[model samples]
Target: MNASLPCVLFVDDEERILRSLRMLFRGRCEILTTTSGSEAAEWVRRRPVHVVVSDQRMPGMTGVEVLREVAAQSPATMRILLTGYADMDAVTASVNDGEIWRFIEKPWVARYLVDTVEHAARVAQHDFALAVARLAVPPPPVVGNAPIAARIAVLDNEGSLAAQVRDVLPAAVRVEHAFDLESTLELLADHDVAVVIARLSSTDGDVADALKQLKRLRPATLAIVVSSLRDSRLLIGLINEGQVFRFLLQPAPRELLRRGLAAALERHAHLRAQSDLLQRHAVDAPRQEPIATTTGRLLRAWRRLREAATLRSA
Candidate 1:
């Protein structure tokens, strides 16, 4: 292996799978294959690994558990969960606990897998460099007890999600509600929303596509999707394309919703404190397919927002 190639670690119980992955990523990355999830976690702790791709159904520690440990040990390392089955619990845990960068299904297209790993490696390298620089900087002084007032948005056709957010969050946090794409874009344009709790419509892809565009325009603003939709593929798409912070089932439990909101708020604060950290949440570019009517209108609205901002500045 060349010493200069970006390092990618693959953890799967099957030796054949490891061998296949090793062959796939041979020339592009410095491949490290291990069947033991524990060993993979240890490797992340001991060295500078650019990325870790783990199988979900491993023996000792599940992929979610391994990625969670990796997150704690080395947050700069990009994490991906590659599994044959779409285990719902694992998928949810991957979002809430592991916070993986992408979820790739098994029997993946060879080119797509390679592209994902390469992108992750490049991102990890930048993140690791940024982490090192932060260590060298003097820490900021701790502020007083006053909580920073921030705005939250709820993009749901119905008022339920907004009401839920209002009930769960403190009164100090202003909650903005938007029922349509135009309104949502206007709200985002006017306010620096720290977190957005958006609904995923079961009937259309418009909501998901809008969320992805929002992330691309504003990486610092965290998004939590609350939906009744149980499609694992859609959730995975949100993870990779939107970098969605969390996915909550409809009628989310109060405590879980509260915890998710708190986490999103804390993450937003961190991003605000260090803008460069936003790159860690970078999402993949939108798909090239033709846009739907709703999403096309959304694009126009977003363009108008940009024009207004530019005019104000000028």
Candidate 2:
């Protein structure tokens, strides 16, 4: 195995599945395969593993539980969950507890799996660099004035969950509710929303789609998903595609919601400050030439006619 290559660990209860993954990722990365979730966790604890991909339905310890332990032990390592079943409870737990970066369904395409792992490795590298940079920089001075309150947008199909979110957030933070995706986009366009709480319905993919668009428009805005549906695939889509900041199960505790919101606001401030700093130091380019004035345009037109007549006569 190449010591320079990124180390990737694969965990599953089935031998054949592990064999297949080993073969698939053999040359691409330093692949470590294990059939026990507990063993996988132990390996991560001892090794400088860059990524861990585990099966969800392992015996003794489920994938979520194992990944959660891994997360606590190695927060910088990227975690991926692979599952045959779309158990919503387990999926939500994996996201909320394990903080997995991506979820891959069982019987995944070979190319897709390879691509996802490569992408995860790159992200892990970037995050590690950023962590080092943060440690090197001195903390900015604290402002004396009261901090600006973040504006939050809550989107729910029936408008009930929105009210619940609003109740938990502080009174100083402005909270806006939208019943559907279209309204949510409009609200985002009109306001500089800092956080989004989306309560998803089982039948509709609108909320997920809306969140994707929201990320494109306001990449710094933090997104929190609230859902009762136990579809692992849907949750995976939200995690991998939407890049949600947090996932909360339905009927969430008020305290939990409040804490999540507070953390999200802090993250938002950090991201916004970084963006502003980049803009401030960005180099200015030469401006485009101004458009022609009315008198200049007339002069140019007269010159063209005289030049045309001289050429025609010659």
Candidate 3:
């Protein structure tokens, strides 16, 4: 195996599938394949694997469980879930537990698969280097001259959800309520929000689009989608495009919401401390607005301004 090439692991019960993947990435990556999820995860713990692409269904251990173990053992390694079936439970579990970098549908385009894995490998290299550096000389938690209260923005038309989120979070964590897209944008612009809890099927606008836009502008701001919508395609979009931190069903238990918010806050703080990792959460810019209205143009300009500010700061 070439040590210079990025290391990639593929997990699948099918021998032919593994063989095909090996052939596909033979020259480009240092490829490893396994028919068992447990073995794949053990390999991750034993060595530095830049990327892991696993099929969802297996006889003993599923891909979600495998990726979850890999995440616990080596978080810096990027995860990609591959499956032909649209198993909603598997997809949701992968997002909440595995924090996969991308959800690639099985029978994937060869070119697309190659490109995604290559990109993830490069990012994983950076992440591993940062992890090593942090271990050697860990930076203190991000704080300034004065304590800045991490803001949480809730984009729910009903005041009830916002109130619920506020009640669970600490008093020090300010929670802002936004009833519509305009209000949400304004709140995000004025405050350095650490987390965003939004519905997928908001009445005011496409909440997913708003979340993607917000992530593009503020890469460190983590988003948790709490919606009744149970569309696998939409969830995959959130994973690939927005890189949403968590997804919860509507009317989630208070304790669940609390735990999710706490994790988001911790992840937010980590991103702030390691700003370079912000690139991991970058989203694709919307190619074309659903409508070419003034609001859309305003959003474009707003995004441009935010990008300019980010560059100047950098």
Candidate 4:
């Protein structure tokens, strides 16, 4: 196995499932398979793995349990959950406790699985490179001496949702509500917004289109999508087209909302710092653009596939 190739570890109780995954990902990555969660955890501790995909329901230890351990053991390794069941408890645990990068269902399409893993690998590589770059340079000064209160925008038609978000956010953060895409754009232009939380489906305008425009206008601004839509295709579209920082299910718990907002603010600050550092060190520091990765292309393809499937069914 080439040490340079990205490593992926797949864990499942079923031997056949592990074998199938190994065959699917063979040659594309350095694949490691194990039946026991304990063994998989130990393996990750011993070696560097870029990603881990685990089944939710195992004999003694569950997938969430294994992933939680992996998260602590290898924080840089992206975790993914594979399950035949979509129990709410498992889903919540996967998000809250496991902090999984992606939740994939069982009987997954081969192409989709391959695309998702490839994308996860690219993201892992990019993040590792960024960490190395940060260490190579001295810390830059604070980006701007803006006000103490960081501005946040909630782009939702419902007043109640915005209110709930505002109530949960910290006192240091100021929240503004925008009922439509036009208003959201104006608000962003007028304020140094750190984060924008928007509904995935909005009556005002196309939410994905609005987010895309927002990114173009303010590359550093973080986007969070709140939606009840369970369609994988639409969610994938948001990931590829909107480049959302986080996804919050509709009627999100107050604690979840708070944590998501805090993380987004922290990310915004880090981005600003990086930008400032580049500008100071390099005379002509070019503006940064999101990487066009194979993952993104795959996501686009997945969206089209879903749409076609839906049309045929209709």
Give the winner by TM-score.
3
TM-score of each: 0.90, 0.75, 0.91, 0.67
Q: What is the alpha-carbon lDDT for the whole of candidate 4?
A: 0.71
Better of 1 and 2 by TM-score: 1
**Candidate 1: residue 221 Cα off by (Å):** 1.4
- Rank the candidate models, highest TM-score first: 3, 1, 2, 4
**Candidate 1 residue lDDT tens string, 1-314:** 78778999999999999999988887998888899999998899889999999999989999999999999999889999999998777888899999999999988889988988898898888878887887889547424211367789898898988898899987778889999868888887877788988888673657787788778778888999988878887888788888999999888888999999988887887777777677677787877421345566667778765665456336
For model 1, the superposed segments whose C-alpha errors exceed 4 Å read 139-147, 288-291, 295-300, 306-314
Candidate 2 per-residue lDDT over residues 203-246, each given as its tens digit: 35546655654454456777898877766666666676666778
lDDT of each: 0.84, 0.71, 0.83, 0.71
- What local lDDT score does residue 100 receive in model 2, on the 0 to 100 scale? 75
Better of 1 and 4 by lDDT: 1
Runs off by more than 4 Å, candidate 4: 86-93, 129-149, 189-192, 199-205, 208-220, 225-252, 274-314
Top of the candidates by lDDT = 1
Give the range of the ten consecutive residues with the poorest summed lDDT in model 3: 285-294
State in Å the error of residue 275, model 4.
7.0
